[model samples]
Target: MMHRTQRQIRTDEPSVAAEALSVTHVTHGLTVEDSGEGFAFEERVRGTALLSLESTRCTGTLSGAVEPGRAMMIVWVKSGSAVVDDNPVKVGRPVLYRQDPQRFRWVDVQHDVLRIDRTIVEQVAAERGDWAPGPLEFRPRHVPEGAPLAAWWLMVRSVAQEVLQGPADVPVERERELARFAAGGLLTAIPHWPVGQHEPVMASTARFARAETFLLDHATEQITVNDVAEAAGLSVRGVQAAFQRHHGITPTMYLRRIRLLLAREQLEAGDDRSVAEIARATGFAHLGRFAGSYRQEFGELPRQTALAARE
Candidate 1:
């Protein structure tokens, strides 16, 4: 999740939103023009793999292009009608595209639209294990109704639901699971070749044991995820998945926890260093957040812990 989140976009005029949408963010390089029927736009997003709602009352064309195979573009019309990528888009059905949609244009003929772009697939895939495959391709077709489709649809909606109404702060394992669903689900649903052919490597718990050894050995030193990854002989993402899966917490957080414990040892031993000095030595650059987390973990402030030992 983001430390700071921007939920809604403000547009007093339809053309103003057109200008805002012109610039590319996590979505796509989209261009919207007012067809004189008026347009209403509001988008709320949290984390990657965004879900957007675009409602159009007038006639307009939405033209843009996204990179091929890196992501999937899906649009569902709950009401109204639209023409997407030169096909008369089916109402309440998902339309999939694999290639960069430069020529892909959508004409909203009195339509309301919901778009889901799995644009962060590459990022998520990097965190999981790697696979070697040829060029991936997704042929455009309708997903037929069935039990399998229903389950997948529910999974997709659940992710969106989690973002909209779920708790702001969740565990690392929870974050990993949500990201897996967003990226993993799209990778399976879309038609891809080599990239999707090989299974993701979920290494055994032994990798976590090795990583834990390294973190404990260097818990007092300033360390990074990359440093931990190098010590474990695994990619950064691989270590992340392993730690979260095995421990339900991230490697970095675990390191921080141990560092705090080590700092407390120093304080209890009547070290000459001040509390701030101890904090700096413990690899906590932000004194405030460190105190907050420390209080939550130990049920007392760092200074209080230090003073208690002295008493």
Candidate 2:
């Protein structure tokens, strides 16, 4: 959840710029072969542990080869263009760089770039049931230039303007949420395996019951659908399908219900804890939201219920 904003690296020396690129972009063995006269490189970066969005502008000619790090980068040419590994990069087209060594030569290129952690892509692929037990692969080409590309472009821009560059004090949860959004958008825009395939299997009654029991047991702990799926021995999609088919609700909703019920029980027991304490003990994040949800589930707010129990 480390957050950095408006970090700038501007230099006129090729070696200095190369070193900066090595650290910021997480590349290794980067060597600059040619730096034409008046060479300049500048980058404005904003990022967290999950992803980074950068605006880079360079003048003159630069050529180098880099050992790709652990990130998957998508570059959108804004003003100028470059050739990535001999593939001609054009303006307005976003090119994806996979987790392989890259050779590049660019002349006066300015790019708006997004680098996402490879682990995030793999996690999303697993949750969508589109991945195997091996390395995740993507088509190393420009995203298709139609609705898909438009949607991905809009999403990235929105996230950059609103979440990354919008405010300095944004919540960590909001950052994680936007990172997941960008990851999901990237998967859709780029071509990958298991797309439009792998329909979830309906969970059996026994498996569904096991999932319910797991939720009830872990109601006071911070858990996710993936945890429930693991406990029930099912895929994430399978567990979601099971919940929809059996209870007409999501697994998250069921967990919330269990938490609310537990909170009510604590109140009825005349526990000497404040409503906020009860809400937090029952795993709610916000007191106001908890009170609203509690009132909706039962007939009164948590404080009202506690007062009645005292009477």
Candidate 3:
């Protein structure tokens, strides 16, 4: 996973020395690393942003601004101290944070920064609203020197190590989940502050919940309403209600959304299958409807998206 980030370098200006900003795509989310080292690197992944610096030692007063729809950000500070609006935040440990319109924020992750995946945060948060952490605000906590945010460091290290050391079984999503869980724990442990709320009930309700498991397992097949209902031992209406209550959407709509999302990925990746073939493979048999839905959701026909991607 890698996000495309904007990069800028300014060596002569007194106000700013040098800068390399990258919005990195790490399994399940986006992270931005900005540092003014001797060099810079930037690339785009799935249309998101990423920034990277060769080293944090040259970084002076690092800061990040996240847009409104960007789920939440989990900041992992490998070194240095960060000040969010003049308040010093302990660095080195992973800090899970979010922001809302009412509570706009300015974060300084200080040194050796890694931004976690927002997609996973938003996805899980959307489904599990109650467990979601609220928007971030300034909080100053004492640092137990030399002990950076250990949990976050370990999680990031493990993911990085896997990227360098593991095999196909080590999917990015798994690494992303590990990071999310670790960050969620840290956020939960932090002290109270006035902030907007997030719902995480979907996560809790879907955790070990049979319906969710079944939906994920069978997302690619021609699963019918009756089949899903039977599998979950509920009436069709009951299952439909469950999806609506949990995901804020109807069951059929949820299925289509997931299917379309999968189809889009396949299309972008240049999968050999044709649009109709891919749609059918993902359980949508009607070519016209599939194409129309694809166009509406992605702002382009399936074939067009694939063609553009190939170019």
> Which residue segments of model 1 deviate by more than 4 Å?
1-4, 10-12, 24-31, 49-61, 64-71, 107-135, 169-173, 195-311
Q: Tell me the spans in candidate 2 whose CA falls farther than 4 Å from its real position.
A: 28-37, 129-134, 194-311
Judged by lDDT, which candidate is best?
Answer: 2
Candidate 1 clash figure, as a count: 1
Models sorted by TM-score, best on top: 2, 1, 3
> What local lDDT score does residue 104 receive in model 2, on the 0 to 100 scale?
78
TM-score for each candidate, following the candidate numbering:
0.47, 0.57, 0.41
Model 3 C-alpha lDDT per residue in residues 112-208, reported as the tens digit of each score: 3444444444443333333344443324342321112222232344444444344434344455554454333233223223245343322234322
Residue pairs whose backbone atoms clash in candidate 2: none
Residue-level lDDT of model 1, residues 1-311, one tens digit each, is: 42213345654465665665553233365677665666555444354334333433324655665443333445455454555555666665555654554344555543332234344455433333243323443434646332223323544555666765666655655655665555544543343333444431321124444465566556667788888888778899998987676444687775666666656656776766888898887678889988998888668898988888888
| lDDT (Cα, 0-100) at 164 in candidate 1 | 56
| lDDT over C-alpha atoms for residue 159 of model 3 | 43
Q: Can you tell me which runs of candidate 3 are displaced by over 4 Å?
A: 1-208
Q: Cα lDDT for residue 155, model 3?
A: 35
lDDT of 3 at 15: 31
